[model samples]
Target chain A: MLEIQNVSVRYGRHQALFDIAAQVERGKITVLLGTNGAGKSTFLKALGGLVPTGPGASIKLGGVEIAAIPAHRRVEAGLALVPEGRGIFGKLSVAENLHLGGFAHRARTDEKERLERVLDLFPRLRERMPQIARTMSGGEQQMVAMGRAMMSHPDFLLLDEPSLGLSPLLSKDMFKSLRRIASEADVGILLVEQNAKLSLEIADYGYLLENGHIVGQGPAEELRSSPAVLRAYLGEEVVPA
Target chain B: MTILVTGILLGGTYALIALGLTLQYGVARIMNLSNGETLVAACFSAWLLFTTTGINPLWGLLIIAPLGFVANGAIYLGLLRPLVRRATSQGMLEVDSILATFGLLFLFEGLMHLGFGGAYFNYQFLAVPFKFLGGSYALNRITAFGAAAAIALALYLFLYKTRMGTAVRAVAVDPEAARLVAIDVGLIAAFAFGLGGAITACGGVLLSTFYTFNASMGAVFTMKALIIVIMGGVGDVRGAVIAALILGVMETLVASLIDPGLTLAATYGLFVLILLFRPQGLFGGAAG
Candidate 1:
């Protein structure tokens, strides 16, 4: 399990995240839902160590404290982040990007097996290996980003807005793939997304964030059926009286 | 035919020199103005080794290249790493690195002037003329060109084939993304800066075999290298090689056909044309 506690982030004087606590279990999908500027990205970045967390914050991966490590070192410790903008090396070929994904010391021993698994997860990438990542379609690039992250053989994967810029149909397919990846790879997924309905549909647990604070948390089924979630994020219709 | 051969030989050396600057700027994010001073230092080292210890410049490369690596690595760690750490953005880093390396340029030049006493230095090593394509050329020039080509080829293979080298290129493409893949961006940048220095110093050793150089002339090579780097595209290895060849041929043609004094003029002419027209470089897409 990956546990996050007392995680707070600040950029200069602006606090992006407050004291947040969350837990993500292996082989499960945990979704974080929030509106824009709700500190969803900041929360994910802090978990990945891309942003500095406040003192006393704790990020534990498989019972090991990892919050103090640098971003790259966090990857070596079996934590990978697919940040916003897809974070794939755009100028490099898909093959090279995937190759680099296995650069962590932990992943090097089984890099070949990981490559095979990644290709199985995103078959489209197998054909586009030689193409530059930036030239691919938005959905395809998302696949590359996810595929690249999987290449690290991460114990925990943090994804920010994985469905952004992807077609609705593609987003559905992406969520399906995420379900498969979590179950088959036995990797914990900490997902931050704006598409509340679809994300809750695939998630095992859910956290609702507002103004950098976790306003509510529950099982995915409960959150999906909750009145507040439906009105705030699902855009429930209001009929005339 | 002779002109073409000579230009190509010259271009080989120029390509090697420009490549170092490209790596330093592209991967390390440093616009190192002192790049040519390392080259000059290598040149003087080659001269001193040959004159005193009777070591061939080709053999002197073994000593000077590694020294270049250590020296450049020290500079990056001791001087530029702080700038990199404190820089808030790419533009700020560029400004800071340019200023810092600009200062380094003068410091190195002054030290070389003191050490070598501001005199043109050259040595006769393999000065025999070798016939090629119905024209005669200096054996040292051919040898220098051959060495440069070999080094460039090795660098190309290292970048394209090896895992560590690919990591370097990955950092060059996107440092933030590289971090996601577990690449140590800081370590890679330092290595690249050091390797770039080594390559540029190698170019200097090769040139010292045939060309006359003085301590103060480092700035001229720096400008020429900068022109080639800009003309090719920042961080584009293939483009730099092509641009350097074009520059060599053009400079040779201008010097031989028009006037010897107009070579620098022609170089600037091409620079202005590149900046005015294809500022993104000959092969690069629209500037981001």
Candidate 2:
């Protein structure tokens, strides 16, 4: 289990996240839905130790406090984040990118087996292994980003807008892979998304954030019918029965 | 024919000098104006080794090159790293780094002046001249060129075939992304600066075997290296070598065909033209 409590983020004078708390259970997907400037990204960054949190903030992975852990050390503690825009090394080949993703686990004997597993999860990546990452399409780059994180074999994965710029079909494919990984691989996924409908469809639980505050939280099925979620995110498009 | 051959030989030296600057500025974006000082320091160290211990200056490379590498690494860690950390903007970092290197240049110049004094010295080495393809050439010059080529080839293989080399390239391409992938970016930058120092200092050790020098010669070599790096399109390694060769031929031709006084002037004139037309250089990006 990964737990965040009373987490707050302030950038100079502006408070990006205020007293935010969330929990992610193993083998489950937890979706965070928010609009632009709603502090969804900030919360994810705080979780990954990519951003500093204010007083009273606490983060733990399986009872271990990781709030003070540095971003580089977070991976070794079984935490990984696929940051917004898919921060891929564009000049490197896909293989090199994956190789770097396994940096923390390099000493492990199963590193090779883990790499083969990532390749199996995204077979298209195997085909483009030798090509430079910059030459790949948007969907392909997203795969490399996810595939790279998977190479680390983290117990918890924090994804920030993974579907941005990807097509609807590609987004569905990505969600399917995420679902399989969460269930079969026993990995916890903390996902932040702008596409609330599609993300909620696969998420076991949902949190609705607005202006750096978590206004609502419940099971995904209840949140789908909640008036506040529909008014802020879903708009006129109703959740399919 | 002699002029052409001499130019080619000179070009190899220029390539060696520019390779260091290319690594410093082109890849790391640090304007290391003190590069010439590092080279001169290596030459002085070799000279000191020769004069004190009677070791051949050619063999002095084993000591001087590593000294240069360590000294340059100190410069990066002590001088440049703090500036990088304190800088709030990229432009500010570049400017501050350049200023810091200028300070280093003067410091090295002053130290050299104090240690070696105002006198010039010629390196003691075999000067047997050999005829090749109807042109007479000094054996030392040929040996220097061969050494430079071998070092360049080794550098190429390191950057292409090794794992740490891949990490260096990855950092060069995108530092922030490299950090996300767990690459210690600061360590990479330091390694690059140290390696740059080592390679250029090795060039200096070779140079000491064939050339006469005083403490102040570093400034002239520094400018030449900067020109070659700019002409070669900055971070492009292969382009730097080609541009160095071209500049060598141009300098030799102008010196012999026109007037020796106009050699650097002609080279700078061409550089201005290249900057005016293709600012990113021959191999730089569309607008680099």
Candidate 3:
């Protein structure tokens, strides 16, 4: 399990996140939903240790406090983040990118098996391994990002806007893969997303953030029919059938 | 044809020198002004090894190359790291690094003067001249060119075929992205600085046998490297080699056909022309 407590982020003077707390269970998908300026991205960065939090903030992964860990060490701590914009090394070949994904545990003997599992999960990457990442299509690049993270064999994966810039069909496929990865791979997934309808369909739990505050939280099915969720997300005309 | 051949041979050393500068600029956005000092220091070390112990100058590579590598890493860790950490923008980093290295350039010159005195020293080793393809060439030039070509090939293989090499390229392409993938970006940059230093030292070792050098000669080599790097585009390794060849051939032609005194003037004139028309350089990549 991954737990974030009292997390607040400040960029110089302006605060981005204010004492936000969240958690994701092992082998389950937790979807974070919010409109623009809701601090979803900042919260994700705090978990990844890319952004610093306030004095009282703490992050625990598998019973270990990881708040003080540097961003590069977070991967070795069984926490990997697929940051916003995919964060792929655009100039490197896909194979090289995947090779670097295993860098955290490069000394481990099971590295070859880990890579084989990642390739099996995203077979598309296996075919495009030799091509430079920048030249790939947006959907393919997204796969590369996810595949790269999986190459690290993380216990918990944090994804920020994974469905961004993908077509509806591609987004659905991506969400399906995320679902499969969370269940079959036994990895906790904390996904920050904008596609509420599709995200809730696969999420086991849901948190609604507003103005950097968690305004609502519940099971996926309960949140799907909530009046506030309906009004803000699914709208009055459509109510998840 | 002879001028072209001579120029091409000399160009190999230029390319090796500029390649290090280009990597430092391209990956870290640092304008390492003391690059030439590193070459000169390596040459001096080689000179000391040969003159004191009566050993072959070529044998100095076993000693000078590793020292140069460590020296570059020390320069990065001691002088440049803090500046890069405090930098808020790439432009600010470039300015700060250039100014810092300018100070370093003088520091190295002073050290060289204190260590070796201010006299011109030429390595008398490899004095044999050889005949090749209707042209008589000195053995030193051929060896220097061969060593440079081999270094270039080795660098290419390292960047393309090795994991650590890919990590370096990944950081060069996008540092933040490299960090997310679990690459220790700081460590990679330092390693690159060390590798760059080692390569330039190899060029210096080759150069000592062919040319006369003193403590102050570092600044001239530094200027030539800057000209080649600017002509090739900032951080473009392959482009630096091509630009080095162009400069070498052009300088040789000017020296042989016109006047040896006009070589520097012609080189700078060409540099001014390139800046006026194509500031991004002939290869056109990020000048940063």
Per-residue C-alpha lDDT of model 1 across residues B125-236, encoded as one tens digit per residue: 9999998889999999999999999999999999999889999999998898899999999999999999999999999999999999999988889988998999889998
What TM-score number comes out for model 2?
Answer: 0.93
Residue-level lDDT tens digits of model 3 in B1-288: 889989999999889888887777776667889999999998888888888897776678778889988999898988899999999898899899989999999999999999888999987877788888899888889888888898888988898788888888888888887777777888888888888888888878878978889998888888888889888887677888999999999999999999999999998898899889878989875453
lDDT score for residue A222 of model 3: 96
TM-score head-to-head 2 vs 3, winner: 3
List model 3 lDDT by residue over A11-98, tens digit each. Answer: 9998888888888998999999999889999898888888889999889989899899788888888888999888888877889888
Interface RMSD of 3: 1.0
Candidate 2 regions with alpha-carbon error over 4 angstroms: A105-108, A239-241, B56-58
Count of backbone collisions in candidate 2: 1
Best-fitting candidate, measured by TM-score? 1
lDDT of 1: 0.93
Clashing pairs in 1: none
The deviation in Å at residue B57 for candidate 1 is 1.9
Model 2: per-residue Cα lDDT over A1-241, one tens digit each: 9998999999999999989989999899999999999999889888877789998888889999988867767777888889887888887899988887876643255878888888888899999999999899999999899888887778998899989998999999999999988997799999999999899999999999999999999999999888888888998686467
Off by over 4 Å in 3: A106-108, A236-241, B285-288
The C-alpha local distance difference test score for the whole of candidate 2 amounts to 0.85
Give DockQ for candidates 1 onward, in order.
0.89, 0.56, 0.74
Ranking by lDDT: 1, 3, 2
> What's the residue-level lDDT of A48 in candidate 3?
89
